[model samples]
Target chain A: MKNAERKRWCLEHAGEPLTPEDEAYLKEHPEVRLEVERLALMAKLMSLKNHEEPAPHLETRCIARVQERIQSRRERGWLYRLEDALTLNSAPVWAAAAALAVLGAGLWVTLHTPPDAGVAAVQEADPGMPPVSLAAVGDVQPSVVQTSPAVDVASADREIPLNEKPILFLRMESNQLPHNSDQLIYGNGGTMPVRFDY
Target chain B: MIDPHPPDAAGQAEEVTDQELVARAQGGDLEAYNELIRRHHRKIYAMVYNMTSNKEDAEDLTQDIFYKAYSVLNKFKGDASFYTWIYRIAVNRTINYVKRRNKRAGLSLDDVDLGIERDPAFLELSARESPFRECTLTELQEKLNKALMTLSEKHRTVVVLHDIQGIPHDEIAKLLNVSSGTVRSRLFYARKALQVELSEYAP
Candidate 1:
């Protein structure tokens, strides 16, 4: 039999009657005898269970301590509860949640906040520039825009300094964004609000 | 008003299960929790004491573990037996404490030697004419405790639980969260090391 199997058998049958086969195995592996002797000593030690009989009233004292802790826990219950709420046991989970919230807010602001930086600066820098009405574009016919054979880039570009441009005010109440993505008709460059004729 | 000390009905009624007591305790029943403590405190205390070899540390730790179990009783899902749950807590916390303290002054086997004179099992061995028939036996017991101290906490824990505490190998496996084979292997190695260390006091 293997050493482990022999050890297992000897342990299982320690201090009990052994079979003839087991006797033959132990006789052959004399080294396992010390293991069996140690087993006997352990059994003797096991019999002395009360050797460590806890100091009298250990249970009563421990229970008293538990009650004290529970009482204290109750007395400062709110602070204990607040600590529990803020205790970051799962740091990664809270970190991921916080990161996702910040990312979502950034995306919302980017997608919803109007591109008003240039317009705001233009108004703030030159408060006297007359607010141009978007309705004025209605008077300039579309044909006039089409009939201009080739636009003079220098004149359009020189008419306004990059920092000093007129602001156009348009009023609409739809939460739905208008599909005015055709930038050629309504493009604004930096502070300059491109004129529209339509 | 709740009874400060409930009757020992749990002990008298064999059918009163730990699960039932746990359920009651979960509903803010302190009396039921007291019964649970009555049933398991000694075993928990002994396990901690054996691991730490310090009675004061064991006392404090046992109280802490019981109170911890009470504080977190609501989280007990009742899938595993409460004994297994509490034993696991006791073993883990004791092992952690042992590793942190990393010192030894244990078990005072000297006390065991003095206590076992009246024990029938030791009497059987004492009946034999042995070398220490005239000795104080304190040195021998001290040697034994020192030998036990030589073992790593993991090895000593197996010996303490299985041999001294009379816990079975399978239950120990569950409590230590290890395999049965691992438990047996550890016990075998631990017993062998201890025997070799104190061979002069051999049975």
Candidate 2:
């Protein structure tokens, strides 16, 4: 190649492994040789000038960051393990069987419970029953249930409408209790007798 | 006749193998990963700092590169050296970052953040030397960087990789996923551009 072409080739291949032909051309052509030498020198100068060490704190920061990522990966690994264990192929069929057992027990309890008379009374009341005070509406028969003046004072802070019927309260165990018992509480406004120790 | 056996052990020991370190790292050796970083961090930083021209962004990008490498350690097949793989990641990320910034900033290639006149290191160099103080090499470097900015990212990256980092063209091609011919042509144009820009630096 001519000088200009050889110089162009040298620039093009600045950091490449030189072919024997290009090496021979540079040996033969003084101008191409000078250009090659200058390019190498310039490359070295630029590399030296721009060769920067990473920031002093980068190693520590990178280690900390990598450790943080590793910790996250560990946490994620546990989740993945859980996923694998819970997958259809990996999980035992016993879990489904256990779920069926609990559901069956729930259904059994729901079917066996007898209906309450107070509940049936409230539920199937002669719609014509006289509207009683919020505190006086209860399990006692209308003939025996007296509206004492003292009862109104205790629950007076709440507005208990005269027309409201007392609702039966269920205990924590889901058993129905009369609203008047101290253990069971009348909510909104109906009273019924329910007895239990606090 | 068999070719004379190359000196294997000492030649191999002279340079740290990224594959070995990566395999060890994947096997849960944290120190191996640290060694990997120690071996490659400077080159990675040089690439980032040249692209960013700011230490802060360079440091952040360097961290991102290694963090990404660490996260994907299991996926690294030995087709490329870990150096080439991470270098490609760094370059691709930087190019994407610049592209995204260009989209938002509406800035052209000529307007990359090559930093300002008062960068402390360059300024310190300026203050200490008489000739450099008279007409600072930092100023000259800035001028060169500005000229570099005028080139497309592809060409500028070629110059930065081949010229500034002294990385070989074949390895650059591997990292850039370009033909060696393409590397050669781009390098020619990049050097020509740089020479015209840096002519004053030559005696």
Candidate 3:
């Protein structure tokens, strides 16, 4: 409670107490004591804040509870630990790498294994002729070569970065082509090879 | 007379830096973890207790907050000191618990420290002609807590953090995911409402 401007300043900054100059000003201008009472209340509240304490041995009890929890966590099955690790860290790099590895292994097993597990024979390609799409020719239907020589360039070593990339060629006479382009189950196109990497 | 307390491992670990304690705790040293808890649990408890205005809820929540900090200790990057980090955890969880409950329970306040009688602020206020001058410490504590419980959890939290616990508004804003302006405004309004509420107890 001082000059209007100074009183206003003290009121606005309630968190802190008044300056000594302002106390002198307030004593001289006792009429504005109403304004200074608010600061007194704020100081009272600050005292309340400082004087309160929680129960004794709070940390000791809290540590006990935390210990019990950690023990239970340790006793949890591996699945719980896995979830704990996943949530505890931000997309851990090892986790990401493990997920990719699992997917890669799953895909490798899927591609290498034949469509029909009953198809006991692993597919083979004659070095002289084009390879068939093993995946496309799901059930290896034995067929008669209706025409003279060969057909679509079936497969090649496309994935391998070899110095002289090996290419397999199949040359069947034009009459032996499937009656409709859509009828060629394994052929990628009427003229193009049905490439196989597996 | 027999010694009431034996030698304690944490007594030794207490001398270690928070950085060392955190590193050891991360490396599966449990005593180091307990020492870290010892270092901070009072402030955390006081914070939650004031916000909830109930001893039991404060106890439960404080325990849960520490357990949470331990469970997720690996995530602590030391980007902030352990004190700030745990305060962040305590503030966030208590706010959430307060909201979820959506109401205050009976105040199970602790005894006002005996030192409050001799506190300069208490002496100064009691000396002045004010509402608190004639009230006993217990009566003042109850009225204060009751008034505090009247505030919205957000406002109460800001007051508890900034006014009571002495945390900076910037830290409170970070904890609440709001701007420093919001903390200030909430505190201003909260203190205003409280002044009115408690002074209603005046003789």
Candidate 4:
């Protein structure tokens, strides 16, 4: 073996006896032997360094932690499973990009679109129709009220006339009304001034 | 708590191959998984301790390594022995950890075990009239660990695996994902660096 190769082999196998061929090569070049001895001593000292036993609690702690992790993963439902699947190497970059794009577009539409656009669309579709207020459905013009003749006369008879103008009261229970009375206007022109009595 | 498995079955469990344990673990046997941890935690801890030179970090990293291995048990293809597979995870995780730790702060050494004084190699070295004898084995261990930290992570890893841990070059190559030639070259350079660093204690 060449000197450099022999030296490398000797350093690599520092504690081990040199092979016959390498030994002959080293004998031929005694300078490499000194280098080999130095490397061996270094390896010996490095090996002599104390082995650090982990704390006695390490195994139990590790097992407990691992068990906790496994339990947590088991408890996680499909959302985490989906996340794992999406994070897998098999999940292509385009799929993630597409998902992000869809989310971003949905958010953009939500933030930019006016909250009352649906109401405006309904009015635009029939410009002659009056806007119906859910809170005051009884206050709708008689003309709009005429569109729906199905209003039960008995309920209307008991209606408290909060405002005059031949009010047609639709007495609905307070719980029946939308949580946000301000946003609960019906789109159709068949408006009735609603009276909610708890 | 009653023993679910018979005594013979428990004996069989002890004798089961790693592949069998892995299969059982994959099938939701917590005991099998714990057995694997019991089998390999020390070696893994030692490897991490050597690389990081901090006991607390080593303990944390060892736990993390096992947790990661357990989490991804399904991904193991059975191509490599569980030992090799776990070692791969450990080596990779530790390398990344060492890199991140290097950016944050310098390496820190733990107090060397008092057992080093009774070690045969340590006794032999301390017997000689050398500068290293002036200090105790624990001090020598501290100095060695500090010197080890001076080498680059790559060099330190090779030295720790090959020289200290006594892993063969081929296995070191497999663990580090490098060629045997690269392992040898790294060992050579690492040893040379360590030699110069510890020249004061040279006999």
Candidate with the greatest DockQ versus the true structure: 4
lDDT of each residue in B121-155, candidate 4, tens digit only: 77777887889779865677778888899999999
Residue-level lDDT of model 3, residues A1-198, one tens digit each, is 337777555554564666887777768877545545664466456547567767776767888898987887888867666766664443574678799999999999978964333212212323433333334423222332233135433333435422234333233454345533322232344433233322
Give every collision pair in model 1. Answer: none
**On residues B61-82, what C-alpha lDDT tens digit does candidate 3 reach at each position?**
8888888888789999998777
Q: What is the lDDT of residue A134 in candidate 3?
A: 38
Leading candidate by lDDT? 4
Which docking band does candidate 1 fall into? incorrect
TM-score of predicted model 1? 0.63
Q: Please state the interface RMSD for every predicted structure, separated by commas.
A: 3.6, 7.8, 2.4, 2.2
TM-score, candidate 3, first chain? 0.31
RMSD to truth, every model: 11.8, 18.4, 12.8, 14.9
- DockQ of candidate 1 relative to the true structure: 0.21
DockQ head-to-head 1 vs 3, winner: 3
lDDT of 4 by residue, A3-106 (tens): 67666777677667668987887788788777888787788788875455567787889888878866776889676555555543223655877899999999
Fnat for model 1 comes to 0.39
DockQ of each: 0.21, 0.11, 0.29, 0.33
Candidate 1 lDDT over B1-203, as tens digits, reads 11111243345447777788999988978778887888778778877877766678889899988877887788789777777687777788788778878474445421443565776765765665664344454654555556767889999888888777777778888778799789877876776677677565565
Off by over 4 Å in 4: A78-198, B1-14, B103-115
Docking class of 3: acceptable
